[model samples]
Target chain A: MTREHLLPENDATGKQSVLDRYDLWGQYVYGFLLRALSSPSLAAELTVSVFDAFREAKETGLTDLLARARETAVAALQTANELRLQEATNFDFRMAQRQSSDDGLLLNEKLGKAQSALEPKCKTILEMAYFNGLSQKEIEGALNLPDGSTGTRLRRAVNDLRRVFALN
Target chain B: MDLKAYMTSGMLELYVLGLASEKETREVERLAEEHPELKKEISTIRKALDEYAKLHGVQPPEELREKLEKSLDGPPTQAAVSSRPMVKPAHRPRNKKFQLGWKHLFALAAVLMTIVAIGMAVLAFDYSDRLAVATSTNVELKEDLSKVSAELVEVKKANTNLQEKLGFLASINTRQVRLNATRRAKGATVLIYWNTDQERAFAQWDQLPELPEGMQYRLWAIARRNFEPLSDMQSVSSPAGDIHQIAFVPGASSFVITMEKADGPDYPNLSRMYLQGSLN
Candidate 1:
């Protein structure tokens, strides 16, 4: 049998969090940059960028850190160690994609391509919400939305994005 | 608690897909805070969608990565912002893929456990089989050893007889006599025994008739004054019965045979005499 050891959640704060630990954040950002760039030099550079962004937001009290901390997917993506999370993400994404047209795939490659082609604003919001660890509440505060409008806008934006991604 | 309303509101699925606006996100978060099932549904949807995204994550080219890296390092590298995603895989999409489920996981575990159990059973069976074979072989070996021991005893008896005969060959006077069963006519014969220095009387009865039931042959020693028993004898079976004349009491010197009860009498049953011999 495959003896897989499931690890405990790594949220140091013990709250709903995605990469709440800095070590994991560094690993994931570095991994993303490495896979996307496939060069150590570029990965190192992007590592600086992600942390730099984090620091800049923190210094200014720009609500971005809270945005990330309270991000909608914090709970699902949390892991016990930076290395395992990075490895799992890298292994699953890098190795296991279908290539043929008639393999009966679930995700729409065309729509995926289109979603990635979206306006920089939409891309930023979704990626920050998904990968950059920004929360809708923080986004609402950042955008200066009325007290109750942030969740509605986020939901509407996401549904639109999903439809775009779903379209063949 | 308000699952029905929550469902019709389409808040749960949208929140799960990360579709809710900032304020809507707060609302859903608040509902999740109050109701565990809502949180549960949220977690499940997020997990499924997250897995889906992970399966289809973008792999930007090394060149694009380099450009992005360079831009992040210093200045933005200028390229036309194309509408197409550079990282999009060059392939068509597929659909209706089934997910791996808990039942499959449990089934796999059960099969693995069964395989282990069967392996143990086979090993135990082999061990028992070996034990049975060894025990039977051990018993047969013991039987063979006992038979060999009995044969060794007989060999010792024969060896002593040969040694006595060899002594006769060394003596200055060597005498041998032939005798017969008186009533047998032609069926029974015997040999007068020999020993060095008059050690003792000895004989070998050769051929004797199969006796009728209720009768046996005996030996007697005849003297001028007394008909005394010399040796113990009975209906003979083997052609070569040992006549090793080991020391007898000083008083008895003659030998004879008679028909008596199965057990011969201590005194000569002269009335039932079948064979007679006397020593000078």
Candidate 2:
């Protein structure tokens, strides 16, 4: 949408209208955060924080605001990534000390293509579990799956991806 | 434990996707710890999911972005996130002992003074800008007023000219003559004003018959002795209240108006005579 649409019809100078226009930047911020966080809900939530920072800064202009917004999203994503790493260690998973690896990026790309090739049900389940970072129980609730079906659906999705990638 | 069976059970995928609960996660960790190969498999699954996400990340709803931005910049966040960076005081317990020293008092006073100075400067700058704008507006208004005053003077001069004409029309020496419309121009009677003393004349009328394009009415003064053509009117037939001057003709006993070329004719077109009158 143009800046005119972002602003109220009558008053473009009003602070509230300016803020309303700023709200449209959330999608961009969310997308940036999602790439780093790998979860839509978390990215969306942090997108709010990024905008809050912008408002707090009392910044103006979409170009400048979006530039600042991307930086804010990156910072929040880094914090979230640290927390996720801490969680993995807290579970005593004994994972390698470092995770932000190039090999992992390659694997994610291959796995993503395989997931996209899966059937609708498998894709939906896998997306909720992997991209949305939802627990099986939460996925079941979100998808309205029958009791105990979430795990079966998740395994089927993973197996489908494995087949596509010729991993099994 | 059947380590090979556990590796193929898809539990690693659940753990990698974060779909495993705290208890399930703990179990997975415990088994992966006992078997290094199991840990490697869990790591591989997690890496795969991360790659998938990087390749196929979905953007949040466009509407949701707006909502989030609103909530961020709106009333809920304004106080906490004002434009100015607020210096947050270090967190301290209410029970912590606090002592104020002279140095502390001086520092606090200095900060307050600085804030006050900044506020006054801002106010002064704002006032200066507003004053400049007001001054410019006043200058524009003055220019407009000057233009309006000049126009008013022109209108007054015009009014005086009209008043002089009216006064002349009301003079004792002015004579009025009613001109009768001819058969061709029925209902087109006209009145003529003649000031004998000033030797000037004008004509007034309510309605005149429509003239053909490039044609006009010409008034002729007919001398009493010979009824010879004297002089034609200077202007075309004028509307009521507006006077059209006719050329002065001394000793003229009558007047006759005829239709002629718009530029007018030196002699009257007797056959096309539209109006005729005799003076008292």
Candidate 3:
């Protein structure tokens, strides 16, 4: 579904109604947290928390929703002891098989391909920085890279993905 | 700086991924305001990552939906539909007026008396309803007035504090001392404004890492060959907005900040010193 379709419209009382709109993007949010957290239960709990905060703030746009989801997930990752398990596992760039037969499959398929095409090192840096919420220095230490290489690798990976998407 | 080169510097990617330091984040934001292309690039990176996350979409457990619904306060109830008031039918007089006997006249008079009593009762109910509404409105106005008065007091207090800060900072007697981060905490810095005339000092910092549980930061003035405590132990999470007033020593040669146990330390723990600066 498009971003516009996911926005909660105001009801007769002039308050934004979110439940139905949430249904449209709940899986998208859950998937994000699930991959970042690797625990269905923690992801679900944070998913609920994100939506709870979103509704209270009466946020209108899709970008705000996604940003909030990322922020909430990052905060939870910091406090959660389960991150040690995530750290032990090797980084994988390939997207897991899509479970939901949703309408955004075409767009997701293209995105999945672009993500999988990234170099292994690039993928590892991106996942560590974005999903694991590690700082550039932390990623550098973890990967045994030089002090300033994490940003360079991340930029290359993102540019590669952007180029691939542009070709499509 | 060349816009194209700056765009390719990977700072925007780090920013979008939230891997950039606070200083870098601020710089990126400031540049984005000057260059629309930079803003657009940031937006594009953010969208790409968001979509990548979306590609991994896994439907949450079915039971979770029910649980979230139960947890949330349900959508607000629809506004109560108001029904239009019924209009009274107009009274019509009969074309032929028959001569009335005494009994008929007596019956007519009793009916008219009952209608008048009913009208008076309706009027009394309507009057009482309006009076109740007015009373409620008066109470609300009083509450609003009290809230505004409290807010006014707070504003005035803040204004006074701001004026005092400005006055101190503007004084020629005030000397700014820069505290460089020590090896214990690299990249962290603090500034101290000491007004020699008044022997009062204030400290400010950009950001500081969170300390371990039950640990707090204490300031020390290295003066007269003694480490004198400059302020009470401060929590790392304390707000950075207000300029913290620190005890100023007249002949202090330097200043030091160290992390110490929340309760036990009366003097600086030299090994835990995080920042230091000399008056010279």
Model number with the top TM-score: 3
Report the candidate with higher DockQ, 1 versus 3. 3
Q: Please report how far candidate 1 places residue B247 from its true position, in Å.
A: 6.4
In terms of lDDT, model 1 sits at 0.46
Estimate every model's Cα lDDT from 0 to 1: 0.46, 0.59, 0.70
**Candidate 3 error regions (>4 Å):** A1-3, A6-16, A83-112, B74-280
lDDT accuracy of residue A142 in candidate 3? 34
* Native-structure RMSD, model 3: 18.5
TM-score of chain A of 2: 0.38
lDDT string for model 1 (B1-280, tens) is 5675664454665566455678978988997898887787565545433333433333322353344334445433335675456785686557767789999999999999999999999999999899799989999999999999999999999898888766754465534545434432246665555443564555567566555555555555444445555454454643356553523333433445654555544664332333543333
Model 3: DockQ score: 0.19
lDDT (tens digit, per residue) of candidate 3 on A16-111: 355564676777788777777666667788887776666656554556667788887777655552333333132232333243455345546765
- What proportion of the true contacts does each candidate reproduce? 0.01, 0.20, 0.42
lDDT, model 3, position B129: 100
lDDT of 2 by residue, B127-171 (tens): 879978988998999999999999999999979988978987999
Best by lDDT: 3
